[model samples]
Target: MKDIARVSLPGLHKSSGGFKSARQVLIIDGRGHLLGRLAAIVAKQVLLGRKVVVVRCEGINISGNFYRNKLKYLAFLRKRMNTNPSRGPYHFRAPSRIFWRTVRGMLPHKTKRGQAALERLKVFDGIPPPYDKRKRMVVPAALKIVRLKPTRKFAFLGRLAHEVGWKYQAVTATLEEKRKEKAKIHYNKKKIIVKLRKQAEKNVESKISKYTDVLKQYGILV
Candidate 1:
């Protein structure tokens, strides 16, 4: 070969002092996306050393008859050896956690490198603040609306999460609390803005009043 093309990563580089690695922080919106496809993409991105944050995990879709898929998951959760309960695989009931487990299955999690890659992944049931306003990318290939066939029924992870023992009420309460906090913050800022504007207007009126008083000496009466 005449030459090897030099390939450099965006946030990963080697230095004389230490091994430096920096990767892209990718934020993905999981709403209305297919679980397997989304998980595969997330796994690939994390393995590339990029940080992946998946939001709205509860809204992710799984293709199949709703009840069938539900029962299938329930059966899988029951897998355990009587003698080695501690050694059996653990499953998560929360929608966010279930989504995380799906992603984990796509990775070679038994190895050290796979575990490290998994550390870069984050999944949330809903859009959390700080990420709520950020630009979130959607996986086109995994979108249910775009790819759904009218004939095949579908199921949402949100419903499955509830059936699997996730506390839906608690999630709702927390989300409501967060919304209230954000609303309060916004109201406070608006109040401060209105106060400042009124103060400025008063200052201008006072200056005009002073100017009018000066005009009194010139025989200009209001």
Candidate 2:
């Protein structure tokens, strides 16, 4: 367990399990490659009664089998519904561990202490400007390397550039321009190819049928 402030016990890795610290705030930004690792770390603290506030949750990863994962996510929400069909208004909300890992990990601790510690966690997608408006500190050297992921492919490349620590907005913008340009060309070519193939097949079929009639007239059954 790495040394972090506000906790009397070492983090999850060192000890057997739960820590009984009072309400401590843990903030994690959810926009980079390290989200899952960070979330797991924060969740452990949360389970120990530390107040956790996650920021930028929408950026979390959904690795592999997106459809199946989505169904699994929906199922979790279904479980959290307030009332069954017979009872009261149905409202479904579930915890997110990318797929199901968060709730599963937290709830399944062997001890009763573990169960009690799992209740204080909270996560969110984005922090409102007001949440940390007072402090505008420079990124730490470790986190200076950390960056936000892009919304689209070009944005991704922009992030890649930023990872190398370059700040090139114009190049990223140009990459998007090129992607769109190439997409247009590809669409046009595909449309033309389909049209040509259909016309060629029609011409061949007509010629073959006309030749078949000629053969029939000569008593060639084919």
Measured by TM-score, the strongest candidate is 1
Please, what are the lDDT tens digits per residue for candidate 2 over residues 51-168?
5555444434433334555455455445543555546333223223231245436455577766555556655423443333322212121131343234421122123223333344
Task: Indicate the TM-score of model 2.
Answer: 0.37
Estimate, for each residue in 36-152, the C-alpha lDDT of model 1 and write its tens digit: 988887787677666788988888899997899989988988898779878878878888899899999999999998999899899987777778766678777778887888787
Model 1 ranges with Cα > 4 A deviation: 1-23, 173-222
- Best-fitting candidate, scored by lDDT: 1
Give the poorly placed runs of model 2, Cα more than 4 Å off. 3-24, 33-39, 74-101, 108-116, 134-222
Q: What's the CA error at residue 79 for candidate 1, in Å? A: 0.5
lDDT of each: 0.79, 0.45
Measured against the true structure, the TM-scores of the candidates, in listed sequence, are 0.68, 0.37
